[model samples]
Target chain A: MTAPIRKLRVATTSLAGCFGCHMSFLDIDERILKLVELVEFDRSPITDIKQCGPCDLGLIEGGVCNAENVHVLREFRKQCKILVALGACAVNGGLPAQRNRLDLRDILEEVYVTEDGLARGSKIPNDPELPLLLDKVRPIHEVVRIDYFLPGCPPPADAIWKFLTDLIAGRTPVLGHGLLHYD
Target chain B: MKTSNSEVSAQANARGARAKAARPAEANNVFTIDGREIPFEPGQTVMQAALTAGVFVPHLCYHPEFRPHGSCKLCTMKVNGRPTTSCTLPAAPGMEVENNTTEINDKRRLLIQMLLVEGNHFCPSCEKSGNCKLQALGYALGVMSPHFTLFYPVRPVDASHPEMLLDFNRCILCELCIRASAEVDKKNVFALSGRGLKKHLIVNAESGRLADTDFAPTDKAAEVCPVGVILRKRRGFAVPIGKRTYDLKPINEQADRFKPLTPLPKEEF
Candidate 1:
């Protein structure tokens, strides 16, 4: 008898976020063990891998508010079969969406320039590797085509696990009860 | 804990009697804001009715979902010539109200401007630049610079959550997030940690980082932040400026136009 299709390749990354999305994943507690058995995390901070390769799923956990985030998201879209905008920031730009209200020049000057800023020793390194901050924060789908959206500030862990299990089982994921629905 | 037949009947009759008595009182009463005449049904607020009537009043703390805290003095409107929070003020018929005036505008502007300087509101670098309610109101009132020096305290970045960023530098102490956490989401994740101008947002029960707290990324408190203080991780700068919320219309106008159970179009997604 043929072995069951036990594992799927998955990659996850954060862009311009506080890493709460990943923490939410951890908050799933014991459910993560079941998740790990079903999916192989190829490139993730938890795994400490640098670049993304081909994967069945790409879980992006932040808003694209900088040049680096845009670059990484583009790569994930190119590599992954399905791209999930996994949180409020990834979907509606979350609280960072408020930054879409401000001008980019003002942001740079406030952090880098001004007497109180530089005089108080706010350092802006001249490192070429650092990604430049964008003028505004934007949701991921606006930059690239997203297959699905799991919108919460950070989606609950059970919701994330349920969505993945549904997708793997070739079934459409149903929304959870009440306000917990990942809309 | 089994209920007897007589007890159940008595409870049912009592509930029926209460419902009947409540219906007439609810029908007879009309909601009003700051004493202005308004047709109000059940489950409506004074602020909701006033905004529906095209009366522009100042407010910072009263969001639609949370109970009115009456903490911010910005929404203060004169009811029977007495200053009161229109958001919390109950609707009563034959109540005279006054909102539009140079005096009120001046006070509102000063209060907002003070909030700007109270924090390190480096407007130039602020993520909530053009789209900020605080900034828009400041522009409307011709507040060019913070007339006073900024407090310029280097606040901590609660970078614990992987999906969101909490920068205390941009907070104006509006308490929208706090109310959203406490009342709407039923999660008391945020609280005012300090006093007066030195006040800052603290996470968890103690003065711990947000990562240490039980703050879920999906909490309304995270979503309700008015400034760039609480930022989502990966979704910023994904959409171009032309497509963002600020580019459409001022938030105040938008809020007024679509107040109290206005259905948003699906395309708004």
Candidate 2:
């Protein structure tokens, strides 16, 4: 007969988020079994891989707040055919962008200098190992062309499930009002 | 009195004629909103008619009780191939209005984006996250993000009142508060100042504080804000998440079909 159906390669990552989106992904619960049957994980948190490979879909779960985040997002955009911004953070910079009002230097001073419980000479970290922070937190789409957006703090597990199933079925995944929540 | 069948029929007809004459006559001028024919009364605006007919024309500043402000042009619709704000436009018979169109929605989305960028809409941390009309309209229109650059304008929060707090940072310059205070509460405590992008809400007190004015916690102005600008102190998030009005259902579903057209709860949190 014809060639057997191939499992779609999927990858996921967190940038400047609290990893709540990944936790929501896990909240998919028993449906994960069905998800695994239809798709193969590649360079995801579950796989612990260092880099993303050629994949059919990529779930980006945070806004870009650093040089490393930009690099990783561009890589995902390059490797994946469809990129989905997975939470409020990835969609609109969420709560992290609140700091956009304050000066970056002022923010650093508030955290590293004004705050107590550090070495007497505690200053802003400048280690080469650490990723450099951006002037402001920006949503993922501002940095790359995002194909879809799931808008929630961490989009409800069922919403994520519906998105995945709808995409797999070759239908345009339009989020309804019941499924879309900004909070 | 003994009556024949013919006489009884005549009496019944006369009584029916009297009852019909006693009733108040309503002039119904029907208009079409997105191809659906909606019957409107003589004095109703297009927005009022559409809302009465269970059709949503996403609005912000146009509250039903107050005169149509027409400040926020989010309800812009094609009335007979000409664009007009439905809130201010009077409904007329045989008028064709296109509301739910791609062109108008795109413009509406841009207006929303402009509003978002102009204000500090921190929905996750703001008290009006679920209950805010502006936020609900954003969701209803499928605005996943504020697609413009963030302005991050510095605005002050007036917490002078013991019972009320005015977070000016979230004000969209809707003037709902101004209308409520002047027309309903009769306090004349609130007003708008400046113009263009600099337009802002102001209190009538010399000290520029709400406590110095005659505004009380029970004033109609206190409950009229569609956004998080006017809020009661210490009552933030009184209703838990997922149980709020807009949280459970979208803004369109919550719109009612009859009088007392204020869909958002008045005193109830």
Best by lDDT: 2
lDDT of 2 by residue, A47-111 (tens): 99989999999999989999999999999999999999999888778778877778899999989
Clashes of each: 40, 0
Per DockQ, the best of the predicted structures is: 2
- Model 1, which residues run further than 4 Å from truth? A1-183, B1-37, B42-44, B205-207, B261-269
lDDT of each: 0.64, 0.81
Q: iRMS for all predictions?
A: 20.9, 19.0
- The window of 10 residues in a row where model 2 chain B has the poorest summed lDDT is B1-10
RMSD of each: 19.0, 11.3
Candidate 1 lDDT over residue span B140-238, tens digit each: 443323434334456767787867788887787878888788877887888887786667778855547777677787889877776678777876667
Question: DockQ score for model 2, please?
Answer: 0.32
DockQ of every candidate: 0.01, 0.32
What's the TM for chain B in candidate 1?
A: 0.75
Q: How would you encode candidate 2's per-residue C-alpha lDDT over B159-199 as one tens digit per residue? A: 88999999998999988899899988888999889988888
